[model samples]
Target: MNINRLVWIIMHVAANIKNYKFSVIYLLLMLIVSCRRSTEIGAPVVNSSNAVLPAPTKQLSIVPVKIDTLVNHPVLERGVIGEWDSTDVLNPSVIKFKDKYFNYYSGFDGKLWRTGVAVSNDGISWQKFVGNPVLAPSISDWDTGYIAGNGTAIYFAQRIYYFYQGINDRGIANIGLAVSDDGFHFKKHPNPILATGPAGAWDSDSVGDPFVIEKGEALYLYYLGQDSVGVQRLGIAKSVDGLHWTRLSNNPVLDIGAGGSFDENGLGEPSIAYQPPYFYMFYTGRASDEIRNIGYAISTDGIHWKKISTTGLISNKLRSEWFSKVICDTTLIAVGGGKWAVWFGGGNLPVPAENLNGQIGMLILDLGQQRDMTSFDANSDWSRSLVKSTDVLLGSFEIEGDLGKRSTWLGPKAHLTLATTDHAGNSMAGKPIIVEGWAPAQFISSKTGQYEPLTISISINGKIAAKRTFVSDDMFRIEILWPEIAQLLDHTGFVEMDMSADRAIVPAQFGVSKDSRNLSFKVTRIYFH
Candidate 1:
């Protein structure tokens, strides 16, 4: 047979290989044949048949991404020395209106915070409105202290509803509403829409940083609630007429992070976006060290939220001089193709809020789109890296860290996502995937004194890949040979191992330690062969 015909036959058979071992052999044969053809075609011939495959795409990896390269300065800078925003220009709430971007940001004039407007045609180059400080503190009203623009401006019913934070003379903060027919002009409501909770309530001290989005028939507002003890958390409220809001019965939907976590100190400045089946939140997380960064969370119903990780999604990796100290207060805009235009506040000084030399910056995030199984490239090979840790795209884990001697446990359900390889979006479909983890067989229930065995189910994307019941207290290895027809990772290049157990157990019940967490299993490592 001709060399070209032999190569064609090899490709045809290799594409249809079902068994992993046979598939590996065919892939090696193709590499050898390609090398020979390269020499014949006057191309550089790679003699070694063991050339390693490329790693995951650089775009998917976690690294220091630069700000808008076109203009490496703040998209919105502080005003002149005596202007309203002379001290700080931060906490931007941006929305696209009629093909233009309207940013409502908080401005500090060394004394008080006021709302200012900056218009942008491209969401990058911003021009401050001549009629600055569009919303200022009332002379003697409830907002006599300051008017914060660190809130949401949502367009609904041909009118823009701007929810903002207002402080009284006593330094108490509450959420207020303003109406705007034109994007620049506004009229304040008579009274505060969402007030502080009752004394000793979770939000008795303050409720600010409102992020409102309209769902089916009602509007959902996510905001930050601070208690009397200075503990801040995230909560949700519902509104029908954009003025009157009812806090969720189970308020403070999202709590602060665990001890030693990125958000251990507090959480605030929530900005939400919808990407179908999942609602994403980009909020500010303050660590115990007083360093702040942007954290991410996801939800299906927008009421119940699960944080993706203990680490911040957008950290101070760039180390830019202007934002060298902290990065917080996110405002997101979906700019198509899984790209989000995120405008946030950064500071060179370490102050958490108010005046810290705050400036506005922007970054673009490319979160891949979900694809169906029918569109998967069956011919692509998986990456050569066989071992992966929990650092990359892990979700619902009880805490963050490596699977070291000190156990890293997952909650009742967890997901491990694998990005497609760099080569033509290589996927893990029809590949031999293995996961090694440790799970306690049974745990004695503290309340009833009954033992509950671990029943775990693993899924790829949404398809059940493996399920097992562990009665013996032993380390387990789950190997699933995913069928080619099940193109699980085709969409979004993600392999979601939806691990669930019958029930989670606390280590304190086992006399293990003082730790109290609902843990299902310990995922040590994942391998693809």
Candidate 2:
């Protein structure tokens, strides 16, 4: 297929979803309401029984943005980072390590395209790697056609393994593999491991954008699956060794709705991060029928998810005039502790700015502090003792090791409660319990500053469970009660306070619960007499 035809194919496939994820055979009986039938390259993809492709959405339209506004919002303030080279910096996925930052992006020069890798020490200043086009098209492999636009969901293990999309000679986009010892250099798979859906399926038209991650022994693949209608569906799969895979019930993890809403037209390019028990997925979606915006979703298990669409995370509110569609290739990096940042390729697709500098942009998300990410087992040495500041401590409190530690805090029923006093026996309100991964911390300033959600989770035996999440008038005292924890407690669990987030929180009355969202922060101290 020619480059222009390929581009149109993607544009067509995303807008029409009625038959997107079903089999071709099913399409034979249930035809699309509207298909923008054309022969840019040749005949369209036949449905099962060799029927014609589904009709495109009649109301489909592209509202291109002005080059200026979109580029300024992201981190590419220094320069367009080689964006002027025609290698559309789409599908921007970046990872940060101890010394340098690595960026993996799609090089879509209007036609033939594939994935590339770049590096930087400071998140802003970048240096493209020698192995620039790290994983380009190789017709000799299963990805026979010219390769282009792709997405990868990743996990940090002994090495980085990525599952991305590659098109074949027939214009079919399929998922393939690549592995890297360091973040920069990569080696592609000898074959296309995952391919287009069977003749009659939601993903039958073509498959693109594979988001990969690992949960313990099982490796999960989250990707965009499309049907002839062009509508996009979020699909998923599981693997044992990260190489071979087992297709789940051919079910979509998520899909876009139709007409006039956030994510109404379609959803594209999924970026995900495991903030402990909860997995947060961020992707691009159309809003108000014309504009594209960022949508958010959270999941405890990668399979089941809850989407929050009432309000989008990013908006044209600040730079409305310069930003048209205003979205693409969202790449988020959590710089250890509790700081978070997101970057993406932005600019007017057909329109160029003054310097033609309309390029990459970043969304700075500073997640105050991080919480403890450890799962506790209350069996080894379960000891609970609170230190009632023998001396009024400021900034730091001191409790010695000889303060009587116990291996068993009264069987399976172990409870850890804490209440703080400031030299005088009184309640203290409005203390900060710093946290992570979440944005717009729940704080109320009208009443001496209040913290809304004080959720914490604990592990019992081998199972993880929630411990506490309640309100406290004495925010300083941080009233914590765990009678149930005291009753079924063991000695394996340890007492620690939250530290990832940098808020001035009272750790004395802190506790844990079975909420997955508690992954980004940690506990440091407990206050008890």
In model 1, what lDDT does residue 282 have?
78
Tens-digit lDDT string for candidate 2 (1-529): 2323322332343334223223442232111100000000122222222111111111111111111112243343322444322545555667644445667766544444556666765555557666656777785766655453365635455677766766555555667778888776677767656666666688776666666655444566676777766666786766666665555673676878556567776666677764332356777665544355677675534565667654456655544333445455566765322234566655443221112222455544433212222322212122231111211111122232332321111111222212222323243233322211121224311122655644444432223433344343222223323443343333212222222222223222233333222221222334332
**lDDT tens digits by residue: candidate 1, 1-529:** 2323322433343344300123442222111110000010122212122111111111122212222211235778999999999998887888877767899888888776778889877676689999988898888877775455666788888888888877666666667888899988899886778777776878766667788887545677787777666677777777667766667776777888999998897777788876433457777777887677778876645666678757786545555678776777788775543446678888877654556688888766645343221211212121322212232323333234433333357777664554334223345456677767777775434432566666888877666788888765668888877563145554234454566777676777667778677777776556565
Which candidate wins on lDDT? Answer: 1
Look at candidate 1 and tell me the lDDT of residue 52: 13
Off by over 4 Å in 1: 1-72, 370-529
Give the least accurate 10-residue stretch of model 1, judged by summed lDDT: 31-40
> Where does candidate 2 stray beyond 4 Å?
1-87, 153-157, 182-184, 287-290, 320-323, 336-338, 350-358, 366-529
Error of 2 at 342 (Å): 1.2
